[model samples]
Target: MGYTIDPTIIRDRFARSTNEQLIDIAENEIRSLTPEALEFLLDELRKRNIETSQIAELEKKVTRQHNKNVSRAHSALAQDLSKEGMKLAVKMKLENASNSDIQEALQNTGISSEESLRIIGSLGEKAAAMNKTGNKNLRYGVIMLLLGCLRFFIIQSKDDLNETIILLLVLSGILFSIIGLKIKSDAKKISEILEQESLEAQ
Candidate 1:
């Protein structure tokens, strides 16, 4: 029995064709054919010992190639964004973004080959804004720590015996300060990693 061109298979192969291939086919092969004539031609091709399986395999090959291109594009885009993010983070002195935040930013930027290069180019400003927000949060935490210490002093001045409160305040300040410095160091390390990754992607 001759093979039948299943409607589903036809649709799948058509979808699999690249834009350039589709344009070429439309312009050169099908330009003069009416809709009915095109259908007749396809039906004739289907009956002349062509296997749908071969068509499916060809479609899969095209799809694989397209996916590879997309993967490469995303890698390049991620690298660029990572570099940009690190530079802005350093400039803003925002040395304390969580790993989750860093990952999310990379994922949301949506860098891929199919998109125009200009779209990826616009993300530098956005990265700077995100880094600035991170810096502001870090500064706020520091201010809150200082204010807490000030409040402890006010209470101590009002009370006659406040040794425990004073000691707690001093120790807490020292601990928090150390933590803040460590956070700064961690951010620096992470930023360096990001820059390296960006370079590798290129």
Candidate 2:
């Protein structure tokens, strides 16, 4: 879905975020940023006059935190749905069944109303989580692209003993961009699988 967010709003939000919050975003939640939002983050860092070396260090500290969170969420979701339950749910979703119909179908299988409701709620939650993860991956991909470009410039400006560090940064950035795109694609697929009309609204 195409959308737009004001750059000033993004900048203001970043401006209000504390240094620790910014670092946390950089290290743990980079994937959650939009490309424009990530640019604003970089602008905020520049406004603070944070050194390139420090930025590089922050990049090095980045980990698979988002992956870990997604893994745990998926594990919980799996435990909530048996093979038969999952199949039934997917079938209903594919059939464009109403929330009430799906609920009734689930309850017909000896599941309680409460359990059926919980299952539906879990599906919504998982879809939302996957969507959020996809957004983050896109943001992280932008970050990688920006950092790779920056390193390429640095490599041209001066001869330094840190060639190995520069090479690693560039290579890792490329690798991350590729991986982020793949993760974003998977997240989109997961969202599609879990998408449904709101039961509450019905």
Measured against the true structure, the TM-scores of the candidates, in listed sequence, are 0.27, 0.34
Backbone clash numbers for all candidates listed: 0, 2
Give the range where candidate 1 is weakest over 10 consecutive residues by summed lDDT: 111-120
lDDT of 1 by residue, 1-202 (tens): 1114565565455456555544344334553433333443344344434357754444444444445656766788777866665554343324444334544454455533333233334334444454555565556556656766777766657563565556665666566556655555555555555566568779
Residue pairs in candidate 1 whose N, alpha carbon or C atoms collide under 3 angstroms: none
What TM-score does candidate 1 reach?
A: 0.27
The C-alpha lDDT values of all candidates are 0.50, 0.63
> Which one wins on TM-score?
2
Q: What's the TM for model 2?
A: 0.34
List where candidate 1 sits over 4 angstroms from the true fold. 1-160
